[model samples]
Target: MDTGFNWVKPMLLMIALAAIPSVSLGAGLPDRIALDSLKNLYDSVQFNHAGHIRLLKDCAGCHHHTTGNLVEDANCVRCHQNSSETKVVACRGCHAAQPFSAEAQRKKQAEMKLYHQDKPGLKGAYHLNCMGCHQKMGGPTGCKDCHPMNKTGEALYNTGSFAPKKTGKAAKEH
Candidate 1:
């Protein structure tokens, strides 16, 4: 029984284990997580973490490789092929909350790695990921759907008070 096929069994077992999604690992995670890394323009998102987990058993759907699931994104796999699960699974871990700030710029310049120089900031990451998935899933893609515009946002967009007032005819109709 000392044939070369002995190694094949262990290799197949490892492959099978890797194929299994990491949903079980998320059992202890909080069901609802408040995403407030970027809350200046809108209220914090009360993300139903557990609901998404149940809906999509694949942890890489949201957490990428942080949940120990191998990512299927070809671009990501190029450099992160061997990347293991990281302790921090939050988006803020990789995407800076204030990516355009002076401090963030300095940090980026200091890092020797140039591969991730164009990584989106926390806000951009949230919008891109959430909106893209929502579009395909037939979920809400409107700006106000997930993020209720706050007073600051209203003023910035010239909304609330800055909205055009009804003139003579329009006012009369109202």
Candidate 2:
């Protein structure tokens, strides 16, 4: 009767209890996330994931109904009133990088969900979600606020002498 498994039950119980608080307090969440899907013009955003979690104290604020939290937006509540948590909670999981691409457009058209017909692309989703909140909360709102533009972006936009010099037929076309 000298089995060594006597402590297993109590140890498991302690671990389970310890995990509950961490999950609720955002202890295991990533401290930062790189939002690089749309990094053509700007550098990948060093998203302060943990900071936002601490500030907002609610995953549903950004993850929406995917966090198993109640939907507050009238539009989202209409259909997702009883929406449960989903496995894929990341924005990129639902919003595509090239949402307007032919393949993406075809897939969107094929989907039966009429409610998500006009779902914005991943880039648009970030801008829409962050910009409005920032404006209201007195956070950074300029284009360079979150992700500063790279050298290529400056050149493309004709910022100073960084603009590529056009010659021959290219110049005439413009």
Candidate 3:
């Protein structure tokens, strides 16, 4: 039987194999981002990319498909909670009072004068785990190594700033 389908099978296999390499395409990070000097980053936290991607199962899995943006949640619990209310608990509750804790900030500021003081703080572990893996994978090993603090990460999905702008009769106009 000289069926044309026999040749088609091999051709399709070849095409699929070629596509596999294309799937991993990455040119490089955007130019808008700057290198992580470490000095420029005191308050800015490190982001662990390798660790986060492992759990998410590629970018498409957890990110809202409709939006196609990386989430900008500073903490993990914020995204895990029901209906994305703000926190697994509360924003002000976890952060407490000011955007930065007033009391803690005061305490840290008080110790700013002391050399090598261990100020209290919490950071996303994804930063460590993911960055650790990237270095192991022979990727960049500094702050700029994985992220651009000044410019927004396109993959990171966020809502508040992206929300539709509402405009009409201002409260002042009334």
Candidate 4:
């Protein structure tokens, strides 16, 4: 009862099993991401996502609370919402710079006040996240470092010369 196809099946199975690891590896860090969700008062911050990935070495540096095993990168809007259970609410959705009416403005302010009791609005969150990290890491503390300004006091969208370098373990694994 010797079938010639017997060897073919096992060979195919081995190949399929070998390919599983590559398939399981998630997507690589993006080259760039525009942090313009709340860009009313200033120019949109152009983040070098891949460069940050290279520098940080772990996605958990920014995307916390995942126990260091990020199946997929969580969107900021997912958890940073009015209600819990991972609802997608944009930064400006709650932290509107200029609401339509006084009532709307008041409501937004109230929501922001309640949400960010200690800090404040979206600006506070940005400052806390960016400036806090910068200060801790000894990267840059100045406001102008993160948010570049022109001579006329306008916020310049400064995409600093950050070339993406390959991250160590994560990049190699992928």
Residue pairs in candidate 4 whose N, alpha carbon or C atoms collide under 3 angstroms:
none
What is the Cα-based lDDT of residue 73 in candidate 4? 33
lDDT of 1 by residue, 26-78 (tens): 34577788987547877888998777887877778888878747987899999
Kindly report which residue stretches of model 1 are placed more than 4 angstroms away from their true locations once superposed: 1-28, 166-174
lDDT of model 4 at position 14: 85
* Residues 30-111, model 3: lDDT tens digits: 2132213332333243443344444444552323221224455545335433333232321123322332477767866887
Residue 44 local lDDT, model 4: 66
Clashing pairs in 1: none
Give the backbone clash total of model 3: 10
Ordering by lDDT: 2, 1, 4, 3
Better of 1 and 2 by TM-score: 2
Question: How many Å off is the CA of 158 in candidate 4?
Answer: 20
Highest-scoring model, lDDT: 2
lDDT of each: 0.81, 0.82, 0.41, 0.54
**TM-score leaderboard ranking:** 2, 1, 4, 3
- List, residue by residue over 41-146, the lDDT tens digit for candidate 2: 7799999877787778778988889994688899888888988888888898998888899998789778857778888999899999999889988999988888
Query: What's the CA error at residue 65 for candidate 3, in Å?
Result: 27
Structure candidate 2, residue pairs in collision: none
